[model samples]
Target chain A: MANMAEAVNVEALGAKQRRRFPHINWLALAMIMPSVIALLLIGLYPLLFAVSLSFQRFLLNRPQNNGMFVGFENYAAVLNDPLFWSSLGRTMTMLVIVLIVQIVAGIGIALLIDSSRWRVLNWTVKTALVIPIAMTPAVVGLLGVLIFNRDFGLMNYLLGLVGIEKINWLGDPTMAMVAIIITDIWQWTPFAALIMLSSLAIVPHEMVEAARLDTKSPWMIFRHVKLPYLMPGITAFMIIRTADVLKLFDMPFTLTRGGPGVSTELISLYVQRMGFRIFDMGVASAQAVLLLILCIVLARAYIHFFYRTPEAE
Target chain B: MAQAQNLQTNLLAQQARAIARRRSRIPASAWLQLVLLLLLLLFILTPFYWMVSTSLKEQNDTFAIPPKILFTPTLEHYNFVLFSPSAIVPTGLQNSLIVATFTTLLALLLGTPAAYILARFEFRGKRDLWFWFISNRFISPIVVALPFFLIARDLRMLNTPQALILIYLTFNIPLVVWLCLDQFRAIPRDLDEQAKVDGCNLFQSFWRINLPLAIPGVVVSAILCFIFSWNELLFALILNRSTGQTAPVQAANFMTGFGVKWGEMMATGTLIVLPVVLFAAIVSRHLARGLTMGAIK
Candidate 1:
């Protein structure tokens, strides 16, 4: 019966489309043309250019040997480069840790706020959450520099109040990574919380009430009732955040500039160093292509596993 | 029988008293949750607070041990950043304004009609087109930054505001298209049909009937585009170094020089952040939808 109804609906929609508009919809085509052209020129062209550039020896500084078609050599070099591997390693480490921390803390805070009865408090918290998201990452990095300063920074000052000795946050290698992680968490955890809070707000009250009657435990209620509603939001967040973390440039760029000694260098910074600072466009383009492929594969995998259409629901 | 009646009456009174007590007192758990939320709010606001405080403090007071909670505020840093003869910030601000405003306007002009088409019409390759637009968001900016820089240099467009404006469209147009698609979808299809019966063509129906209704969503997306363009660092840093530096890049420039002018840098940071935070607060309710490309909402 369901399948038959859906078939009828589809047939009716098709018939209506045929009656109202032409099969080609010329007006629609015309309207979308400019944006399509712009996107192609600005978006797709640059990507294709980069891909083509990756297969050559394009040195910006030494324009003499540039544009020599060294097929696969650049990719091979990127693969062999230890800096490439280490930066990729650092990026993945940060991605895993940041995603985990943000998701857990974000949802936990959302649940806390959602469970509260005060309307004003919810509004205030949500409004406050927007500040971090609004902050420019580069400026945030500067703030991180100040907050993590070894001598007179706020982090150490606060620690001193509790009798803990000051720690060199950006000076030491391991500690610099930690400081970067903390700054990232501080800046973005609110994003997770706000998104999750919005998700939690839409949880079906009747279903939650039914679950409450079944068991007094909040844990069981959340597991059975709220988690399902929150899944799509979480999945969406993961897809977006994964892409973002993979390409993260601004905050770390300003905060540590990939180091006291290259310890904090992620893939994007590595690419920047190669392409701009070192003037090796070929290697950078190769790394960029690889990163692009990784993003597409991960996004596709996420949609395959977790994304559900309204029809599926 | 009399003793049984008295026992029942006593139980009723006890139940009433318990109800009254519960009504009079708040739950401890709720109090704890509220406290935690306030702490989270503080955590979210502290960096901003620090930025503003340091921006306003005298240079000596900025580095005070224990970080002075109370100090004489000064506008010297702000004056230096805004009015000094050699100041780059004012020019950066102007460039940022010009680029961001134009980017928002153009993205909307080009994106809205396409969004309406995608939303209301059924066409071949629509799904592919939509995906293509959205996937632009996921592409690491580094991929395009170098190529764009080379192209800009070749065309002599480097250090020009136009370069940043054109490059930002790669992301902003997609964002506008996605956000407005959701908005257009929410409007009833019957309105378009009504306009059609009233002798309106497709474009006229879209412009006259639907566009007004979708203004709020359009404004939200515009604000977002503006914020993204204004706060953008990498493209602005790369494409326009001297003549067309935006506020964020100017703020970043403070770090490159010797002795790091902390006060002036904080002031620049404050200027860069102020408008974005205000716009963000205004659009906070619609933000999750915007940030997630309307997927979650």
Candidate 2:
């Protein structure tokens, strides 16, 4: 076994040597330098700055006492603040609910589209899905504003057409959250659907056919065959969506402005309010750091749980 | 025995014909799927429809009690949004175009070569470097927004289109790198070796050989980069408030000032979304991979 391992290592080393060309390493480093430098200046610098700012007492409103090292005071304050906790709770609620709704609806829609026999309808639905996914979130929010208008809005009008009373969609707190969720679902469900559709496309035709030959039900086939193929893509979508929802800002910012008295205030909005609106950079940075940690942890956890090597499988 | 064999074959043929007939006819479940998908399509397209329709409606007609389903559509709002002197959108659109174009160009210039090296070369710390590039995508914009604002302010670059163009690279370059790395990987390494034998340098081989073959993927990346830069709001909102606002920021601005100008806002919204949706449709086939950062593909 030791001799075999040594032979493999020698062979790998020989392969590496053969792959190398004269002056390649320098060229590679030179080629990659500009991007690395750019990222370092813009991306890494700000990240480090935010970390440093989190440790300091920096307030844009009070420049006189700026940059004073405050240890964990900002972090402690952020943890103690009811607004922080509430906004975090709101964010988690949105994340969980949005994930569940989008995943289910997306998979359902994808399955329907996949199973449909009409090529035109399939093409049309797939084409239509791009609009929402491509729409600018700010515009989506603006559309929400117009659609959810109390008196002249299309939503209320349509609701009234069904003989329902006009509901103050954005005015009431619960309804405001509901409105945000609906707009989000409307915009993002397509994304989820598209991902699932692609995943469904990879479900082996032969496998399904064989399953059918075995007299398996469609549900059984999907549960046994299609689902395993969908899991990785779904998990990836979950990670991407989780990162997005944690930083959910643009749509809700324009839709409710964290309004109806902060009912719709997500964590990103909270940080924006603290950092930009209230100009409390220290606490905001602390919160940003915490949110960053949460995102990394969740992403790592998801990968750990769902990500498996093909060999392992 | 011959009669029995014939009868069995006849029964099998009858079953095949029955199955074919069933397959040819649309099932109830299929019809149900059609209805559900049509409704889903409607749900997806309604906002777009509303935005365009509202953009065309007159100011008074915009808030009509029944919501003007059949009004004479007017271009007055579009006229005001596009041609009027007080319009914020055209400049916003221009700034958006300039910033997105430059950001794409710069990101391509800086990222494509790096992506090539990352794809083809086996170097020390390659894994770390690749992860570093990708991990940039995971950082929230808010975390960087404040520091960027401060840095821009310190450099006296605030409210300049250059500020946005430069800052957008922080994300766009990573995106370009991530997407183009996959593109470069998909190309055969034998092409590079052939170019080398023909006396082409490393850069020439990349520029001439791999890049042409990877052009489709590069264009996809470019389109995605342009769309992202075009649609971004938070950085544009913070970094470029008045003079350098993008179209999305301009659309959002309409919400903040005075009574909500639904007609004008929708007009702006329509304008902002039109190019993105069009571009998205053009590249819709690759969007699943792009959105997932090439994980699915």
Candidate 3:
């Protein structure tokens, strides 16, 4: 996408980019409108309509798009459902577990790789990290399913060598959610590492060296110098990752379909099932509203902390 | 808080000893660092290697109790995916490619100019617009799935390529705009101004000068958009009940079907992964170029 634009731009000075209008870049706007319109109609409308329909009793099978203006009934329904609360709990649990694992593991691996090393090792690690990021979420889920099947999975086979029982990875309500969480971490930890690596490059090397000179331990230097420096990046990644995980559908959908009887069903999975299977748009929209609100809260927090410089305050 | 403090102390103490011991010479821990880095690479890469290996392994090989470290591979899986004897499984590669291509083109057409506008112009509510654009990215795919499914069904176009294409545009378009915005900002606007002063209009400036300079960014976003849409499952699953199921969705359908055919699944998996790997490798340079969007300015 980037190359095509540059290719077009290099043809002339860039006058072809502008519109004929004095105030408006109408021509530029003109070229951009089709996509924006599509985005608005498809992306914007569904989102807006979700909020709109959340207040109504909408059903997919029904001819009517709108239903009775039931104020907060759907919200009440979600709030009332034990399943919703459990899914929320599961999501929160998964969030904490995966976040801790990724953040710690990501920082650890990043630190290890970022240390003085042969260019070959550093390059190989960096290269390996990029491949998973490039893979589709659904593909990752399928791979997990293949690798973790109890009767004949690689994970079980590995466990067998250690004298462990073949675990029912996608089965057994007790462990199914954990399986989803692990799969997510497998796919995303690299993303966390990559972002941290990018920010780690910008960390003040002199400070680290000075700390080293002060007889500060590597751990101490990292705590006082690196952690503070990486804090913002960590928070930024958390915000991004949190929003992403909260919205996760493809992996869970592919791996377990929110199964072992909904134990692994995330809020997104619940909403998707409700919308698609039951055709309950009202309930789905309600779930969506809840999701949007959570997302917005995190996003606001992210901007407040990361995008806003202290000087502004 | 106490545990955290204790952890901090323990970590610091360990670090202090190591640093104090190393500072005298400041000799590099070449072997240790190299080993640690290699371990990290292994952590990142082993699973992917495993995925490719599974794709190559025979049924007996994939399920080998000890997990075959090595095996003779076959193209049975690829044969099944590319040419299934049973017509029950829908052919999705063409639909996926078509939808992905259309979505990319559509996103580029709309996204490039918006990026230009944001990059070149100082409009009222510009920052707000940018925030709005970025904020949309945070919305989960499922949130949009419900209403989209509802509307598409109401239109009676369920299971059609048009529906999948429509749903993809929702996210792809915004991503394009945001990505292109960054790229366009890096491009110097002086050229556009020059072209304008030279009697070239806004569109003329963009098409003739700005677009060409921003191709690297455009291609990067376009490829991402296409790949994502191709791999997309939710909308494809919901909107496509029958004919227009994509490769990923079809692959998933195969996963859940009874009597898991490891060979066929492997073949499908291989088919799915090959294009993405090629796409990444082929356009890796553009990715690097696009990464420096703001800095190069």
Span of 10 residues, lowest total lDDT, candidate 3 chain B: B288-297
lDDT string, candidate 2, B1-297, tens digits: 999999999999999999999887878888888788788878888879999999998889987887667999998889988999987789999999999999999999999999998888766667667767766766788888988999999999988989999989988998898788888888888999899879998898999999899998899999999998998999998988867788888877877768877778888888999999999999998888888776676
Q: Write the per-residue lDDT of candidate 1 for residues A127-239, one digit (tens) a residue.
A: 99889888999999999898899988999999999999999999999999999999999988888998899899899899998888889998999888999988887888888
* Per-residue lDDT value at A271 in model 1: 95
List candidate 3 stretches off by more than 4 Å: A1-35, A61-66, A306-313, B1-28, B87-90, B281-297
- Going through the candidates in the order shown, the clash numbers are 0, 0, 54
In angstroms, the error of model 1 at B154 is 1.6
**Which candidate has the top score in TM-score?**
1
CAPRI-style docking class of model 1 based on DockQ: medium
lDDT of 3 by residue, B1-297 (tens): 999999999999999999898765545577677667767777667777787888788888887777887788777666666666763333677778888898788778777788777677665676666666666667788888877776887899888887877777766776777567767777776787689679998887888888888887788888878777877888788778677778888877866658887667656666676687667655543332222221111
TM-scores of the candidates in the order shown:
0.92, 0.91, 0.86
The TM-score measured for candidate 3 stands at 0.86
Q: Write the per-residue lDDT of candidate 2 for residues A1-313, one digit (tens) a residue.
A: 9999998899788777766743446777889999999999998999889889999999998899999999999999999999999998998898899999999998888889999887998999998898898899988888898889888888999899899999999999999999999999999999999999999999989999988987658889888889999998788889889888987889998899999999999989899899988999999999999988876676555445533321121
Fnat for candidate 2 (0 to 1): 0.73
Ranking by TM-score: 1, 2, 3
Candidate with the larger DockQ of 1 and 3: 1
Q: What is chain B's TM-score across the candidates, in the order shown?
A: 0.91, 0.90, 0.82
Candidate 1 accuracy as lDDT: 0.88
